[model samples]
Target: MPVSPRIGLVGSQGAYGRWLRRFFEQRMGLQVWGRDPVGDTALSERALLEEVDVLVFCAPIRQTPEVIRHYADIAAGIERGQLWLDITSIKAAPVAAMLSSQAEVVGLHPMSAAPKSATLRGRAMVVCEARLDAWRPWLEAFLAASEADCVRAEAEQHDRVMALVQGMVHASHMVQGAVLRELAPDVGGLDAIRPFASVGYELDMAVMRRMLASNPAIYQDIQFDNPHVAPMLERMSAQLDKLCDLVWRGDNVARDQLREQLLERSRDYAGKQSVAEGSYAFERLGYLLADLREPRFISVFLPLDRPGSLRALLSVFEQRGINLDSIHSSRSADGELLFRIGVSRDGDATALQDAVRAIEAEGIGRVLEASGIA
Candidate 1:
């Protein structure tokens, strides 16, 4: 009879720890033990450390260094066949520690939010292969049980992508939060404005809500741990300055040139294929640049009084199966609102028209210019 894998989860009382524990126990049918690093567990860390074949360091990113050092030290004394793993978002530090530990370690980063009920359909597990030949079977089997697809990538590569993915996303949320908070105190008249709900608005709002709900410490860890933040922020600032110059100074030529440059950049980065009329930039499946052929500029106009009106318009698109490739909003100098959506060629243009009509008829929003992807 085959032996079930012995699983040890460090910092089990914490959310991610608990999430992994319950998931493995219920799905993988493994004998699992959890050790709270805070010393809150009934079992001693050492005692629990002794019994597992695989140890997952699931502590928060901030706690990762100490946890990694301690675990590396502990694993040095353990048996040779044990595999050490970490499920933290930031990969470099823990991957280094695990590599130095000589415990046949592999780094894993789960891309999904902690499974709402721990059911892992359509989730992705990124494995930084230290020794895939040795650990692949077990890792594949374990993740398979939870219905997660495995994506193999290098540790540094994973961190690089994450710096853009998680870092940029959370930063956007933070910026939105700041904007919202700045507007909150004077929002007395906001309620009087019509509700402008749209799929894009809901998407942004969802990001905002999730960021608001996340721990500040975690956000700080993400900001500081991502070494890519500085250069990226600088580039973003430069682009903003260019846009400001165009908008405020009436630099049409510069604006047009900048717009073309942006389109060229999008093609270089996202691909040259026209974005389908209704699909989001995210769902644009292909070479990033080759697949994104839409003219790089778009503008949306809405009534100035209701910012939420944008959200309602996006919701209408959702109902009609339209996708927005790139989107941004701003209030015009004359008290009119504008929304810009970059769409794909295959995206449903008729749906966008219907949504626009609905928004206008319901007094939910005003469309200043709705340009279709060429």
Candidate 2:
């Protein structure tokens, strides 16, 4: 472990692997190599062991412990003083396997999907430092480069928290999706029901859809590979049974029990400030959903990344006296920066169309979509 370690990724073809590859190369200016079983990676296991100072296991959770164990056996005493790290959903087993290796070991869990950005800015990262002697400074430097809100935890503690945060939440949503699928036909499928959905319903739908669209293996591994998840699921099931029984009773005593168990007792556990913060967050999200649902908006992609590009685009709308309701900018999954600008509902549609034409004609921005207009 020098001032900058040459990094080796065990699953460099995967989503988080690719993201970390870019972060190492562009953000930290580090030399890197990767070996993936599914693809033809540049480095072999032996090559990675010999070449890189830091080895990161980014393989799926199910394969991670075995991967670490294989590497540790082959590189016995050879990887001593080198750093071994893993970015997996569950930490206990992988961290344990790595501790058996000669390398300095740590388990990392980033609290997000591979983002479009180069760094994990504004996101949380859990660090389980199993062993560190000489590599401590470099590890701190690496974490600093990531710009994550790093929280230190023991490997066992990390797995327990993840069981609640990821396992229980995902299980509940998956069950909700099942319920929706079974009963949607009674009210006409999702498309028909979505129109009348509350903001909370729409928010949950977004989370459920995101899980469905991603690689099924990632979610499957989270549920199965983590040992703590079974107890979490059992507790969730028991709570549902209690609620169901309370609903069936349909009496004053049942109502009191529901209030005490579901509301009062939980609120006391969660604390007043936490509930207040959650309520305010809900209101903010409700406002955003309302604005988006209006559909009187356009998405634009500006070709130039220069300063005046956005102001010039705004001028085109100003020229038409078309006031915007809201404007938001975000990067696409592929990293293209795009803007979504909402038009006032009462604004003249023809003027907005003219603005779109002018912006494109003058090369200010290309309008991607114009929803909710004739």
Candidate 3:
């Protein structure tokens, strides 16, 4: 079909680039040719510019503007009527460079990391439509396929908001992570700290751990590359210092000022409704974490996708009289569905083992993992 456009990914070896490659070729059924400096068979800039119907810049934040500028210079009016898009976190500069070409351009920010899911179904994606006359319909189609909650904003506006939403939050977590790095050793590492962690701390640690686990360059660039981050960080540092001074003073006047500046002012700024919604969301996350903290669980994979696949798996536990605390489903990296069934650890531990044995023996499902069972 002529409607199906061949896709060109500029930085194909990067995490998001690889994800985009899978998304385009497998999800959208479009042929994707990638050109990455370190990976993929080298595709010439000329070939990519001339051949691919849609060219997406998935390059690193620091390199994106330069890459776009080079393409724009060499395109030489040949870029006319094509769709050029970038998925950089910071938008203004890359969008500006892309605008140098005649192609229809848009800057996109997914508001999250490269996800495990096939599509960004639940994530927010910011769209900055710099140029979009002829390719508007095609762009809409791709956005729809991405399944992201798309919000439109100007390139300058997107950068400003990310300075707070992304940059500020990341810097805070990075600070916490640094403190944890030192204090963790003093307290015998995270395993020792885990028992005393509150719901909020647990949540914060999850964010910090995820940041530490991923590519350091991404976090570094989020801080260093964003122009707005420096001023934002200064404001944050001032507030933190104010808090420290208030605590050190330890007087009623200081306490009142702390309450006013930290609590009352913040609540007023965020609004009662927004604060209420955030609290409710946190409560829900706490409940999910509570369910997951129980170590007594079995992860099973159903080989068949038939009607009774899940029912059969449940029947094993039902017949064994193993009372389940919770049941949750997740996908493997390969997209195979896995069910994590939590059962009462207080009840007969032998019965749980029996269920695992029966599930494998009867071909109900494969026990991918089970606690207290070899």
Candidate 4:
């Protein structure tokens, strides 16, 4: 009979820890040992080297970096071949730490969670092969048994992609929540009702809900620890500023040319590579409208300074059968205003802004910004 691998899990009570414990016992048919003395089970971490064939670090993202190195330091002192693995969201730092630990290491990340007895069907798990020859077969078997699809990625690639997939998405929803809180409309108002909620609003709220339910520490670690996020965020901010200038100056021709230029650049970028295993194109244009959720709408900004401008904007939008989600506004240092209006997909944002410019009535606001709304 084949001997079962003696597995030691450092964390036993947390959500992921419990999920993994059951996964190995029920699915992989492994002789899973809990922390206990005199039963070939490790009662403490110090005794891990005696019985464990594989040590699984199933700690939260924030705790993994510190705990991985701590255990790795201990493992490094031992003079035997032991397999170590960490299943954490952020991969790069832990991979580096494990390399420093001098133990046979592998990086694992389960793409989705079984918050409550969720099966692994159609889910993805990223596997970083630090020691492929020794551990690959067993890892593949484990994943296959669990009904998970295994995808191989480098440590840096995982981190960079996650910075956008998880980090930026979370950040965008956070900004949405902040905007809603600042506005503070009645919870029972029309805005809260089903029919009144546009796709963009619903999608934004859904993202916010997911973010709110997650561990704050994980969000903080993902946002601050990743090194690649800053440059991406800066580029996005600069793009927004450029869009703002185009709207403010009423340069419709320039704006159209710039939009085409941006789209062309996106096409060029997307042509170079594949994402999620060639399943999806990798480009800014395709992903840009993802945040909007309803890509058919064009949003216009109306300065709050114009007393009746909001009503007028809505009237024009309504006449044209445009879907207006919400108006985003902020105050400037010189008492000027910045406004972001969300409208239906068919309505041309540039055309709407041009119409507003033609109105040119006294105290009517200029279009400060406009963009496609998903």
lDDT of 4 by residue, 255-340 (tens): 78677766667666777554333435323323434434544333333445446766775666566555565455544433354555
All candidates: TM-score: 0.70, 0.95, 0.94, 0.64
Error of 3 at 194 (Å): 2.1
Report each candidate's C-alpha RMSD, comma-separated, in the order given. Answer: 13.7, 1.8, 2.0, 17.9
Single out the weakest 10-residue window by summed lDDT for candidate 1: 284-293
The residue pairs in collision within model 4 are 292-374, 294-374, 295-374, 296-345, 297-344, 297-345, 300-341
| Prediction-by-prediction clash tally | 37, 0, 0, 7
Q: What lDDT does the true structure give each of the candidates?
A: 0.71, 0.91, 0.90, 0.66
TM-score of 2: 0.95
lDDT of 2 by residue, 47-84 (tens): 88999999999998899999999999989788988999
Lowest summed lDDT across 10 adjacent residues in model 2 is found at: 37-46
lDDT of 3 by residue, 1-374 (tens): 13888898999999899999999989889999989888676778988888888899999899899999999898999888788999999999999999999888999999888888889998999999998887888788889999999999999999889999989999999999889898899988999989999999999999998898988888888889889999999999999999999999999999999999999999999999999999999999998898889888999988887998888889888898888899988887676689988888786888888888999999888888898543
lDDT of 4 at 266: 68
| Best of the two (3, 4) by lDDT | 3
Better by TM-score, candidate 2 or 1 = 2
Predicted model with the maximum TM-score: 2
